[model samples]
Target: MLSFAHINNSIFAKSPPFRTAAKRLFHAALSQRMKIIPISVLEDNYSYILVDDKTKEAAVIDPVEPSKILNVLSQTGAKLTSVFTTHHHWDHSGGNVELVAKKPGLAVYGADARIPEINYVCKDHEEFKLGTLTVTPLHTPCHTKGHVCYFVLDPATNERAVFTGDTLFIAGCGRFFEGDARDMYRNLFHVLMRLPEDTWVFCGHEYTRANIKFALSVDPHNEALLAKAAWCQDKTITVPSTIGQELLYNPFLRVNEQALKLAVSKSDPVEVLNTLREMKNSFR
Candidate 1:
């Protein structure tokens, strides 16, 4: 098994450092566009601060714990200008009212009317801005009828990240609480997966360890799954997994693969996904 450091180094080693002055300058530009700080809250949930370095303005995603979010904002000196709630779940949107009370005039964006203090109810593919970052809200309605995943891009560097609340996780996916397999398939493959391969995936919960365990059970022979398990063993937080990396190990995204279909004795992609979710629901 590879140590955590070795695993990270190996994954990042594919891209060698830039030696040319122009390339170095490009790297610097990429670094300054956006900074994502993951704030762990309430057992396993994650609330994020998306900071646009150029403007010193930030947006908090699923600010479930207002105090922690406020503390980070104070430390970073980034003015909290907006709130991006992925869904109306209490764990994800619980802090909205408190957060708004503390900081007035913060634009609270979401798709559901049930979302606390949701002023800007978003439509599918509604594009908005925060400082230099362009945020596109994609309607992903599996986890909930109004579930949404925020896809944020910094045009300056073209850097991307998605805040997938309960829809998609590192190696596993959320339970089919409100919708069925078809809805989840669309959320995972059709919507979120369609983003650029390098887009960073910041999900709602830090359930990587448990999710990887379940993933390994179904994909025991998968090299990528095994490597991911090893990589996360020593880490406490695992919020940001890239789309490209998820395609390799996430079984939910691999429903079309022959091996995964065989694992559940199904060939049709949707049926395979359905069976996989059922199996996951019961997996210890």
Candidate 2:
């Protein structure tokens, strides 16, 4: 299991600086064929470049900043063959039209027709391939009716990752903007939680610090959450938190627990989740 302590040590063993440590850890962990580059865009949003080393073919997820993504592609020497649009939100699919203009003939995959320049509409639980990597589009509708989280598997080493655009965050979840609490509950518990425990979670935003703050408010005595909160104090990039780690810390994933149920004076998981979302909306 990749604990926060292990992650901290794996990152900062040789270097004291955050950026240097992160870069070293990122490269060191890329022993598998799949390589992920998390690019910061629009202040807090994250755009990822997932590369298949064997084929040198790459796919960009929610590439809001095309210029930044293009620059990274140049450095990696990987061909950008496709775009995985998570939703129809402007921040997620804003660069679709422009990106297609720059690099035409790219397959733009999305579930919503509202997504600009989207050509391939992915169905629920649709499985495809990007090079040797297996891509599964999981339709998680809560933040939006068409929100889809991309679950990718590296068959060579059995490594897994889920690109949860807005449906799921590090220790929190996105607001139920389009759907209700029940939709979010099913999306979180049924769809996402079914993935392997070690599956790395690459969320759409850099909101770990803030999410941890709120998580601690509801589940204050949780040692895992406390450890994560302390680890996040000095960390700027907190992507790639595993599904097991989230189950240990994230309050959203702990709705069935008695502590979370008592936090909002609710026994039913759905009610607790609903109350928790309301509290989060008003928190700080």
Candidate 3:
């Protein structure tokens, strides 16, 4: 019902500039173009709508509810093309059936073979395109064996944004439900940490305030952690921290920090990660 070109143009105009301009200039300059929309759902989950204003085609990520997302598409006048699932968790994938029912023949992409009505099963490092937007799927298996995040490159602004489902949160990581501390360590430090410092992290939940509180207990001497915790308390707002910010305040992500290393009783990155995760699990 919506004009695709109008929606595509709108997103292109709104996309932010690349966080690492210098590093991405060459690669991003030659990539496809697209725009993204983030729709918050289910108290903390964020469902994203990636639309190419020029083509009016759109994709949604981790939709927990359909009505809200459908309304957004209608209001913005964008045609829904696909749905991307990070994992098969109920909270993250519950809306799939309703959405598919509404948009018959719509393709739903996910790494999990167990997800309902999955038409396009994705793999790690797999690439897909919608209009001018190019999305790369990173198979991060800590939260769930098939959990995957989508890295979007918008050529119009030459920027990058990642939709990190449950694998990564604003200032915390997901619980090791299907994987162990080591898997999460690799996912956070080796995989995600390798990205640009300024990459806007559009995570799954709004648990920033509570996560930072626990982080403060782990590293009481961390000025940034304390300050962020206090600010979160004062404003009663969830901090949409970036990966760079997490490196500074998130205990799980800061396994190598001298103070965190000391608290965890280990200098080894993996051990530090394990200790921190254990502490957080018991933390009230």
Candidate 4:
């Protein structure tokens, strides 16, 4: 299991105040906009802090613990505007109450009406703004029925980052808790795969090492899968894989791959997904 103790220290070290001042002066001198600061949270879950260097306004995504998040905000001196919850799971949404208590009237957004302390209930494709940052909510309900992923488009860089909360991961997809293989297939292949190839994928959880092990079992002939597993072992760090990379190496994503199709003994994509998921569950 991964430890989260280091997360709080890392966020404080990269606080917004330091970045904001530095970015503002740099932007003014160079006539370029500042890049956003992303803070990883929990064991593998990432709770991003999108700060507007021009305005010092900020928003947080899927805060698992409020104390650590609030500490980062306090150190950074960034005004907390809103909280985005990807799902109702305790690991993702447990900090909602305390966070709202700290920042009264703060809007907490989630697709599930069941999310605790949700101030703004969002739907698929609903758009919201925090400072200059615009986020679109995509309702992806495979891990859980109301699970949502937030896609952010930075106006300055035109870069995209998808905050996939539990629905997707580095090399594997989430368990079929509230949904099934078909639900995951559409979410992973249809929705997420449609994004730009370079889009950075920030998923929930740090299961890459274990996920890749399962991936190799399903598709032993994949050279890329073997290499990635070795790389992950060497780093002693969780691999933050991209959507494009997952497409190439993840058996769950590559349901159409011949090796996976043969392993599952099914030509259908959905059946392949089911087989891959069951295989992952059985993996040590």
Among these predicted structures, which one has the highest lDDT?
2
Candidate 3: which stretches are off by over 4 Å? Answer: 1-35, 234-240
Question: TM-scores for all candidates?
Answer: 0.89, 0.91, 0.84, 0.85
Candidate 1: tens digits of C-alpha lDDT, residues 119-204:
99988997999998899999999789999999998887788889998999999898888899999998888898899998888899
Report the candidate with higher lDDT, 2 versus 3: 2
User: Which should have the higher lDDT, number 1 or number 3?
Assistant: 1
**What local lDDT score does residue 239 receive in model 2, on the 0 to 100 scale?**
78
Candidate achieving higher TM-score, 2 or 3: 2
| Preferred candidate (lDDT higher): 1 or 4 | 1
lDDT per residue as tens, model 4, 210-270: 8888887878889888878877774333434567777888888889878889988999999
Query: Which regions of candidate 4 are displaced past 4 Å?
Result: 1-44, 234-239
Summed over model 4, clashes come to 0
| Model 1 residue 14 lDDT score | 14
- Taken over the whole model, the C-alpha lDDT of each candidate is 0.82, 0.85, 0.73, 0.73
lDDT of 2 by residue, 168-253 (tens): 99999999999989999999999999999979898999889989899989999999999888887876667778789899999999
Per-residue C-alpha lDDT of model 3 across residues 1-284, encoded as one tens digit per residue = 11111121232222222211122211223223454556667776777777776687889888778888887777645789899898999889999999899889888999998777799988777788877777888889978998998887666665667889888886688988899888998898778888887666778877878788788787888888887776666332242346787788878888877888888779898888877777878889
Model 4: lDDT equals: 0.73
lDDT score at residue 79, model 2, on the 0-100 scale: 97
